[model samples]
Target: MNKKYLQNFYNQYKVFDFLHTIRQCGIISFWIFLSVLFTTSSSLLVQEYPGKVRQYTHTIEFDYVNWTFDAFWQKFLQSSIRLEDYLPEKQPSGIVREYLRSVRQISQLESQINVIYADPKITDKVAAAKSYQLQLDQFNAYKKQLAPYAESTLQSQISTILSENGLTLIGQPIPPVLYHSTPLPMALIVSPRNKIQQDANISLLADMTAGDMAALEDEVMKNLNVSALVVPIGGVGIYPTMVMSTSDLSFLAETVAHEWTHNFLTLRPLGINYETNSDLRTINETTASIVGTEIGKQVLKRYYPDLLPPESEISTQDTTSDTSNPQATEPEPFNFRREMHTTRVQVDKLLAENKIDAAETYMEQRRQFFWDNGYMIRRLNQAYFAFYGAYADTPGGAAGTDPVGPMVRALRKQSSSLAAFLNQISMVTSFDQLTRMVDNPPAG
Candidate 1:
């Protein structure tokens, strides 16, 4: 590994370590996962970009070093249990169940910590990754050293609530998994290529496509401190992890609904082979975002009604609740969703007419021409739809569907129930099959 990349990973480590010190705070797949899929996808990811499937099951360590943010998890559990007044009723076995849950949670966490440090952790594909470091395992050991004792106390308090509420719970381990890191918000780009030093901005992680990034340099490896709390990593099973500010807990379910969709699909990124493939990246993501949005709304409406009502338009205030102390300003209504639904129908028809170029041009100027002339631009053609599809909602990527999204959507559509959906897709064999199975799911 380039020392510089090692250094960069260490820098990320230090930042996560600091974030952990804040006692701070913190904080998924019950399917409703499938609904995120069962969406509008009807294309394959592999043919679009070859050699997509890479590995299986990422181990994400979700650490909450600071206890102050414990409120988020506490609230999340309460929403599900609906235990408004836990103290009013308590069962004698409650204490034992709560303790057992805690033990199971922490014990599993500890075992993972041990595995991370083991030499075998990266012996497979990760071993050859340009950014791989023999000493990176120690970062987990460092994280273990920094967990907030106060947070443990907070967990204890949370345990009491579970005891009284007729529940024995360990909140989904912050999904996929969370990690305690020093206060740095940096991320290390590890894969067959080295790009950590090349793309150091935190914004890039949230913005750029992993497949299109520049190559990593040897000098860049020396850029960081190994002792930092390197956290919630992005790997096979552990990714799309985000940092939330002191926003309201109210919208977390929605956020979880969104991210968990990524975890389930396990999209194959393009550009990992250094420009060998790029289209796959887009297909995976666009599919995921579109699916996630649809599924999240449906899940919220189906299971957690109080958090997300059926008939109401989701307010920005609710979505950003984690950060707002009292007031998260209201977001403007997106009447576009209503209008676009119908427009997409027509747009697809145009795309299928074989005048893709003409369709795209028509759609591009439709909105601009109409907005300037004072008319609604409803007939956006296929080309324009393709253009927006590449936009992929939350930034990053040059074009097409998001690999993660499409796979999840495809898997769900194939299975009758969520659990069955997960079981079949969890361990796929080939990238070709993975893509074909979902986008062109067997006709039912």
Candidate 2:
């Protein structure tokens, strides 16, 4: 009897361990999925999907950013980390400085292309997208050229970023499926791993509504980041409508940079806990946006100034930059970065009042206010921001800037060495630790 009892206990222990592991691997609902669900735009189901691209006569031009993709990326990431070098008169270690500088170049290029394509320029390519077939052959050719580079350079860095997390295969080495028409918002994997199908479009996911958000929260993203809803919708949406995955060199130049920032802080335990909180979420995105944009800008300046030109004039398409605004309808005019900053301010005031339900109500009210302001904002909720935090910001109690997103503003005030800051940050295990390192470091 004693032997039998011992065996049964062992079996139960095994089952408990097995259950715990599985439970740890899955997702929870993001509160944002509860925000809004509209009647499926019959438009989504229309027999012929109205293609989003436009038509033009001039053959669409594929302007090279000039620098060999590798050189461009290296300089970009270097600039991102140099701030730390400037900070405290110290700098990022060579390895991390190289990694982040390259990442900055990659992310900003992605943002730039997204903005460029969205603008009224490139009529030929736009037309091709709208059923006109233009010569994307050059674009395809460049993509092929950068294929190995992205797989090796950008993807590898991404792995380093996600080393601690089990989700290491976010980017694969497989060849991309090339489409004749420009797939809007390139690079999206609906089902994890190789689903035997491919879509490069990964820009604006705005059409999603409350119910769809719920389904996705219940069925998809929540399993990864329960606060996925609060996560800001990434990718460019405007005259230069674009997404994370644009081109190959650009892929290395951008997508890897921005997305990897998400992978970095996401490995932390506490950041995961607040993944469902809006204030926490904004802090994450704002941080990443600021960092990523700065890196991108500097990289462009150094390596591909021609492709992005030093020109300052806005394209006709960029009427405004004002979304992510707890107050606006679009992501620009004020742009996502500034909007995030302001939202940080607003969410703080609302939270201090401590009328919790009222605060929640404000989410929907603000979203509705978006519609009232003439822009289409699907839903608003704590979940929306929660999932958004993965990008760059973190939960700072009262909700300041996150430590991750690729925002430029943060770098503006960074201490001596980008390399030193990165070295200290690389080993951190939680968002709080990362922020503390950034905000107040113990003497070396």
Q: Which candidate gets the maximum lDDT versus the true structure?
A: 2
Question: What's the residue-level lDDT of 49 in candidate 1?
Answer: 22
lDDT of each: 0.35, 0.35
Task: Give TM per candidate.
Answer: 0.32, 0.38
State residue 75's C-alpha deviation in candidate 1, in Å.
Answer: 17
Backbone steric clashes in candidate 1, count: 70
**Per-residue lDDT of 233-261 in model 2, one digit per residue for the tens?**
34321111123333333333444444334
Which tens-of-lDDT digit does each residue in 361-412 have in candidate 1? 6456656654665545433333233333332433222122234344545566
Where is model 2 more than 4 Å wrong at Cα? 1-211, 214-243, 247-252, 260-291, 309-357, 372-375, 389-414, 430-444
Cα error, candidate 2, residue 62 (Å): 32
Worst 10 residues of 1 by lDDT: 194-203
Off by over 4 Å in 1: 1-175, 179-240, 243-252, 263-279, 286-304, 311-364, 369-411, 426-444
In model 2, how large is the Cα lDDT of residue 387?
36
lDDT of 2: 0.35
| CA lDDT for candidate 1 | 0.35
